[model samples]
Target chain A: MPDATQSMEAIEQPAVIKRGSRFSGYLRAISAMVWKDLTAELRSRELLSAMLVFALLVILIFNFALELDIRTRETVTSGVLWVTFAFAGTLGLNRSMAVERDRGCLDGLLLVPVDRSALYFGKVLGNLIFMLIVEAIILPVYSLLYDVNLFHPGLMAVILLGSVGYVAVGTLLSTMAVQARTRDVLLPILLFPVVLPLLVAALKASNGFLQGFNMEEIWPWVYLLIAYDVIFIAVAFMVFDFVVEE
Target chain B: MTHSSDRRLTPCGVKMIETQRLVKTFGLKPVLRGIDFSVEYGEFVALVGPNGAGKTTFLRILATLSRPSMGEVRVAGHLLPAQATAVRRCLGVVTHQPLLYGDMTVDENLRFYGRMYGVRNLQQRIEDVLEMVGLMALRRDRVRQFSRGMQQRLSIGRAILHDPGILLFDEPYTGLDQEAAAMLDTLLRDVADRGRTVVMTSHDLTRVTDLADRVDILHKGEIAASVRRGEVDLAELPALYFSVTHA
Candidate 1:
């Protein structure tokens, strides 16, 4: 048997405490988690490739189905873009969390000595970054296909706001879905209903930007997007601990 | 809050683990009946039981991975489900699953956990653990490419990365070849020798006899007997286990 006193003395102890305040430590943990996902995705590219391919497929199908002439193209571009993003964003969000659950990474993450909310934010940021990267690639492709400059600054802002709200809610709901028996089919059903408000606001604000509407005309949708993002992110942060709890 | 003077002190404090009438249930099925168990600092306790005997449930509660329904549970002196975060800081758990990202290399996986724990001088610590697990050469290899035994070794390395005061092993040797099992035996012995509080659950009575100072037979959500290593004959564990469980 091991000697308690001898073992205690032999254990290597840290000479200094390098930790910052609780808040900074929490933030560092969150960033570390996000970095973990990004680096993993950078290497595997499974989630990104799946999402990008799916987005392009949806866009390609829409190009033939809509047959948008110049007049109709202007009316349909915003709707098509937003719809593509919503569907593609779900793929990234579901896979990002599902991979964690399947690979036992979620349990490993839960065991870390950080706030649960930090884990939630870390996931949210990682999903958000992946979504943005897919959109960044899709935007130019859509621009080239439609012969329309989709690089407007206002439109970009709306996309960012829309993604934040979408991922904030999606990340929480996906955690729940991943634990279910029917998770493959359950996420979109659970998510689509709850996310209608954000999607509506994103579509309208996107259209407002695409049409070059005045701030007064576009403010309502932008305001709705901002409000949706803030409310969902806050709610997800608060309720995330419960969602991941066994 | 009574203190025992005979208890040995650890780096953290005395009384590494304590529980009173711990109970756990899933829906209406009670998995763990009211049971009192405690482990002192630097003790190695093995929980052995038949299937569905609540052995894993008990270990899970200690790991702070699962909550007990009705009991006062404290690990490393922190109340569970209430101060779980504080408890997690002092605890290391090795579940049946490897609990590692296969997509990342061994080095990357350790780096991620090292940063999450805010470990100081993390690079050196990662190198140390890799060497400890005998995976220094495989540090840059993807975990998905490693054999099951290698992955298990890496998982052990991951758990000890933070140097937790308490370690919980849940069927860690479930699926390993003879070579891996022998390597794990050596590693477990090293860990036990370090005098950290270790609680392991396994059905291998013969194996547990060699490692554990005390073997607890948990039957139907209750501890039927606690056999001290010094009192019981190692070769007679199977018969002793059957007599008590059958009764």
Candidate 2:
């Protein structure tokens, strides 16, 4: 019984190294990883191009279906914006992690001497950047098309907070989905359900800001978004090492 | 370039890789029953085996890619499944996959690895590795545009870019033609001559016979036989291998 217990303990022991003495080095590795993904996308433009076109198409469909008159636009604007970001963000996350798995780049990254959390943060940051770029372009277009000013600072803050929460969970889930046999259909099924609460909070906060709600009225949703981002980012960092290990 | 002589040394002064009863299983199936293997520093050892002989599994364990079900595996004094990051610092691996980003150029690929290793003077080091693998002329070419041979050469550059103390190669010559194969042989010989601990898994018996100082037969998940290169004649290896395994 003692021998069996010892074996179980050994098997369950974590493989993560403590983040000490090389925090600066890990930071540099994280930046290098972010740069790697950006350059790869710059050359191919495959991931971004697909995501942008898909996002524009989804918005176009929404415009037609809702007969987006001024009253309809005002009421549905926040829902439209969050929906576009959520759907498109999933597309980008799926492709980014899939590229790493398909090209064997993930294994290459693992073989490096750097900490695995560095890799996780690098990926999260990269995916977040991609989501932001798409959101940035879409915001102006949505404003021009609907004749509604979408550049409110509060709205932008809500977008950033919501994107952080969405991407943190999406990156973790996408890495898992990419390894599955049915990755194409698997990501949304796995992601949308997990991010349901984040979507609710982001939508509520974004709408509150767009409608000129005071801080006292919107404080609860803001707190929820912040709490979601912090909790998931921490959880993702802790569990990401096992997800990528072979 | 000065070799592992300047690298950290264990108290005993001998750099070695040792495994005690390493075992790996996939669900109900046992791949590595029990593996007891060791290689000294500066020795170029080759692992040869049939298709399902578990050579890849064993090498993967040493590379810290796969964990052992139960055993003590140590590389250069760091125990694995626990001290993986420490072990990774001193190891280099070349797998069947090129592991290069296809859209990125050769320079971009090596630059990424150099940053990960936190290599000093990264630009100069990148230039040196490119020249070492004879990819200087094609440094700006996308990896997807290169042929199988060129990609393999660039991969060799990637593996050695970090100047690791221990190197692992898994069937590196799988897709190379005669000329490309010869180029790789020269590079491997140069690396081994520089006194790095080298372990390679290969099915090409004739080539490994010439390059490896020692060859071990991995059959049924364990080392079946280990012999020095000097003792075996190049022509009689096949018959000898069959005879020993059957016996």
Candidate 3:
């Protein structure tokens, strides 16, 4: 009974240091994951390079397939952007996670002290950064070719919302996909369906803005994108502890 | 939530790992049953058994990498399930998976885990770990460029960056060449020398005898047998295991 009591006490207060300062500790953990990912990307540059090139190729193909004459460009630009993002986001997400899982880095991360949710955030941030970087370049290139300015603040906001939602689901799905025998081919198939709502909102909202639709017209899509981002990120955080457990 | 020891305890000092009748299974299958185990502050213990034994499950449970069906598990004196995060903080685990982002560089991989573990002086810590794993020069190289052994070495670096009080190796030696494995052995010993505990799961009995302070044979989902080096009969393990497994 005494040992049992001790054991119970042990569980309740495992860390002698009450996480010191709660918010600081959580932020530190989250930032650390993000910083590591960013630095790693800075060094290799391969992940970003591949994502950019693939995104460009996707835009190129869409250009020919959709036959974007001047009149059609306005209607198609937003759709084209989401299509490129959805495709390119998968490239970044899959390679980002598969590399970790294949090289034993995931096991290494699991061994450490920070919360597992910190990891989920770190990867999501890392993937988002990469996706945004690719989009930054794609938007400029497309604007030069099609004469449509995608630099509008509202459109940028939409991109943020869509990217967050895209990555939330992507990160979770990638975790599972990488563990399967068919990792390389499985990521996109799993990701696309999961990110469909994000795709819908992004496509419609982006188009609404690009096509000169009013705030009232764009608000619903924007709201959906925001809600999607928040919901999945929360779900991902809750489920991450289970998925990453050995 | 129940005891003083379990409440806000210092992981800086303790026996490192302790479990009481740790029980676990996959679905209906019992992988570990009523297994009581513990390791001293700086001891190295080997978990040995044939394929499908509970070796991995035991490590997973101890590492808080997996949940047990029943029983108690503690690491660095942190009670499990309740203090799994605390246990994770003090314990470092390296499994067969590399777990690094291939899209990132070797430098980035080490740096990321260092931060995730919330180590202080992260840059210096990353440098120290990179040196420990002998990957400082290659840190800028993308993970895709690394060979299996190089990646495995980096995996070790990632696990130890936070200076865990307890370390776990689950088939960590798989795919590691002799040189890499030897380096890992030396690293493991050095880690233990720092008053940290090390628990490793492996199939190589001879190596376990060579390195471990004690050895436990896991058969089926239970601890088939456990003993110190001399007490483990070299010639009889196969037959002993067969009987334990059969029983």
Candidate 1, residues B15-134, lDDT tens digits: the string is 678899999999999999998998877778899999999998998888777889999998766798899888887777888888899899999999999888888898999998898989
Runs of candidate 3 with Cα error greater than 4 angstroms are A1-20, A182-186, B1-15, B96-109, B122-157, B176-184, B229-247
Per-residue alpha-carbon lDDT of candidate 2 for residues A78-165, written as tens digits (9 for 90 to 100): 9999999999998899889888986577788888777898998999899999999999999988887788888888889999999999
**Ranked candidates, highest lDDT first:** 1, 2, 3
True contacts kept of each: 0.45, 0.44, 0.50
The CAPRI-style docking tier of model 2 reads acceptable
Docking class of 3: acceptable
TM-scores, one per candidate: 0.94, 0.92, 0.82
Off by over 4 Å in 1: A1-17, B1-13
TM-score of 1: 0.94
Tens-place lDDT digits, model 1, residues A1-246: 345444443332222124478898798899998999988998899999999999999998998898878767877899999899999989998899877986577889999878999998999899999999999999999988887788899999999999999999999999999988899889999999999999999898888878888889899999999999999998998899999888
Alpha-carbon local distance difference test for all models: 0.85, 0.83, 0.75
Scoring only the A-chain of each prediction against the true A-chain gives TM-scores of 0.92, 0.90, 0.89
The residue pairs that clash in candidate 2, if any, are: none
DockQ of candidate model 3: 0.35
